[model samples]
Target: MRLRHIAYALLMATALAGCNDTIDGAIDVSKVKNKVEQPLPGRIVAEMQKKNMPRNSPIMIRVFKEEGKMEIWKAKADNRFDKIADYDICAWSGKLGPKVKEGDRQAPEGFYNLTPAHLNPNSKYYLAINTGFPNRYDAVNGRSGSNLMIHGACSSSGCYSMTDAQILEIYAFARDAFRGGQSSVQLQAFPFRMTAENMARHRNSENFEFWKMLKAGYDNFEVTKRPPEVNVCEKKYVFNQQAQGSGQFSAAAACPPMSTPPALTAALASYEKEYQVAYAKAMDKLDGKLWYEPTEAERKAIVAEKRKGRDLAYAPTGTSLAAGKLVEPEEFEKLMAARLAKQTAKPGQILTASTQASAAKQGRVVLPGTAPGNRSTMSVQTAMAAPAPGAAAPTASQTARPQPDMAQATTTGSVPVPAPNPLAYAAVQQPTETEGKKPFWKFW
Candidate 1:
C-alpha cells in the first residue's frame, strides 16, 4: 500500500509539471502575437501618407556617423524631398569622428554632390550611390582628390557601407535620381549631432573651433527642425550665399574678402599670357574686332586674310605691352601646340575626317567611373510588368502588403510625415548664397 501511494504521488507531480509548462508557453506566445498585431505607429504611417513617401524624385542622403545611421529623402515629382528610408551602416574602419584633412582615412565631414558621372553601377559593392557633392569646404581649404562613396556590404577601409539588403533600398533611390534628370545627388555627412555634450567630449582637441562652426549649423538645423541650406561651388561649401551666383552682387552674404588690385592684376596677367596665346590662335580662325590698335595696312591685311588663316606679326608698343610681352608668335605657337597636344581636349570641331584622326591620336580621356576598374557597365533588370500611361502608383489601399520586422523598425525615432513628390519644393528652395572659398596656396 505504501509503494502504491508513492508511485501515485510521483505520477501526479509529473503531470502538474507538464501542465505548468504548457500554460507558460501559451502565455508567452500570446504576448508575442499581441505585440505583432498592434497597428504601425501613427507617426510613421502619417509621414508615409503626408510625403506620399517613396515616389520617384531626387534623393538627399545624410549620414550621421555618431548615430551609425543613414537617412534617405526622396524627391516627389514636384521636386521636394520627403523622408523615405533610414539605413543602418557600418563604418568598419577609421577613427570615430569627422574627417578633416588628407591621409586621415576618416570619413569626411560636411556636404558633397554626386552626378551620373560619379555613379558606379557595376561596383563590387553591387550598388554605389554617389554623394552628388563632395565637401566643397575641404577642397576650398585645399583638400582635393579624395573619393567619397556609399556602397553595399559591410566592408570598407573608410567608407559608408550597408548590408546587401539595405543597399537594395538605397540603390532604388539612386537609380531613380539618375533617370529623373537629377543625375547628381546631394549628400551631407556629419560627425555627431554637433551637440554641446558631444563637443564637450572633445574639449581638449584643437579642432574645437572647427567643430564649433559645424556645431552651430547642426544645432541651428536641429533646433529649427530644418536642414541648414548648403550651397557648394567648385568643391567649396558656404551657408550664407547661393551656390551658383556672383557673390559680388550680394551685400548681406559673407564672401571671401576681395583680394587687392595688385593681386588681381598679377593673376589677370598670368591668365592672359597663358590663355591668350591659345585663344588668339583659335580666335585668329574667326573674324573679330581686335583689342590691339592695328595699322591701316595691317587692318587691310587682316580683312583680306580673314578668309584664310593669318600669320600677321604684330609687335609690342606701350610699356604695359612691353612689360607683359609674350614670346614671339612662331615660338609661342609651337609651345601652345605642344601644350594642346598634351591636354585631353574636349570635343573640338574637327570638320574633317583627317583632322579627326589626327585629334584622336591625342587620345581619348578615360572618364572616371567609366573604366572597368571603376565599374561603369550597368546591370539592367527587366520589369515584370508595365504600367499604363499616367497611372497612379500602387498604395496600401491598392494592395496587400507584408509587415516589416518589428525588431528592425523599432530603431527609427520620431519621424514626421513628408509631402509626396516634393520635387518642386526642393527646386523652389533656391540656394540663397553662392561663393567659392579660396584655395589654400602659397606662392613658391
Candidate 2:
C-alpha cells in the first residue's frame, strides 16, 4: 500500500510539471503578438565615410522650417561634410515663430544635439531620433526647455516629424554613427535661409532686427568650419565662433565698402513697408500661425482681401491702372488692353480719342499732320516745330491719296483716307500662283 502511494505521488508531480510548461508556452505566444520590431541597424553603412566616422563619430542634422527640408551629413576626412541623406520633414505643433517653452506648440529654432539617453523605442511617434545636443547658450541663458527629438510621424508637439520609412533610414544612419564612434549628433533648425533678399523682404518691422543678427550667425557658420558662439549673455549673436580646432586653418578676408545710395535704400524700405504686412499675414496663415483661432467671418475677410489684391497684381488684366489705385476689374482689363495696343501701334498711327488724356497733357509729344509721300502718317517733330514763315505746308499723304476735300483739310489740317486692312494685303500679296508653276513642274 506504501509503494502504491509513492507511485501515485510521482504521477501527480509529473502532471503538475506539464501544466507549468503549458502556461509558459501561452505567455510566449502573447509576448510575440505584442512585440514591436526595429529595423536592422546600419543597413546603409556603405554611404558613410569610414575614416571620419571613428567607432563613434558625432552626426549633424539641419532642418529648414520654411523649406520643409532636412539634411543629414557625416563628418568626413579633411573635416568636411559627406552628405548621407536628405529627407522631407514636417515640423512643429505651431507656426513659423521660435518655440519659447513647453506646450507653446512652437518648434524651437537654433542648434541642439542628440544624446544616447534620450532615444526611445516605444515612443508614441514610433521611433525617436536622439537629440542630446544642448544649446549651451540656450541652457546658460535659460532660453528654451530641453528634450528636443526628431522622431516618427504623429504630428509634432514640438519635434520634427518623418514618415515610418524615413525614420527607418534615419535609424540606420544613427546606428552607423554609433558604430563609427560618434558620441552624439548636432541638430540646427532655422526659420529660413538667412539670405539678405529674404530678410529685407520680411524683416521690415523694428521687432525683426533681432532675426537679422541670428541669420548672420547662421551664414557665418555656413562659410566657416565652426558653430557660432552665443553671446546671449551679452544679448547679441556672435559670428565665427570657434569649434575645437581639428588642425584646419583659414583667415577671413576683409569686407568691401558699401556703395548703395541713400535714395535706393529709402526706395527699398518704402517697398518693404508697402508689401510686408500683407505678405507676413499670408505667410503666417500658410504656416498655421495665428494668435487667436480666427472665426470663419474674420478668416474669410482676410482671405478675400489677399486674393483680390494678389489677383489684381499678378493676373493678366486686359486693362491697367495708371496708378496702383483700385479699379473695377473689367474696366482695368479694358484699360490694360488699350494701353498695350497704344504701345504697340506705329508711331504715327492715330487712336480713338478718350477723356483720360493724362499722358498727352503731360507734354508727351504727339504725332502731327501727315506730309505728302511720308511713310509715317505724321512727322513727330511737327508737334514741337513752329510753322515756317510764309511757307505753304506740304499736304499730307491722306490728302494726296484721297480725292481732295478742301473743307476737311482746312478744318483739321488733315484728311482721312481709307487705309487698306493689313490682313487683306497679306492675303492678296501672297506669292502669286504663276510663281509656283515653273517650267519644271509642267515637264513633270
Find the number of clashing residue pairs for candidate 2: 22
Candidate 1 residue-wise lDDT, 1-444, digit = tens = 999999998987685444322222221222222221222233333465677654345677777765567897765544445667786564333434455454555566665555455556567765665443224355344543244567765555456766544565566566555555563465767755543334333322234334544543443234323334444332223332222333331212344333323432354345434433543343333222111211223323333433245223211111111122123334433433443344434566323433333433332211112223321111100110111111135222122111100000000112121123323234433232135332211110
lDDT of 2: 0.41
Give the per-residue Cα lDDT of candidate 2 at 242: 24
Off by over 4 Å in 2: 1-57, 130-134, 139-147, 205-207, 225-232, 235-444
Q: lDDT for every model?
A: 0.41, 0.41
| TM-scores, one per candidate | 0.42, 0.42
How far out, in Å, is residue 115 in model 1? 2.0
Poorest lDDT segment (10 consecutive residues) of candidate 2: 402-411
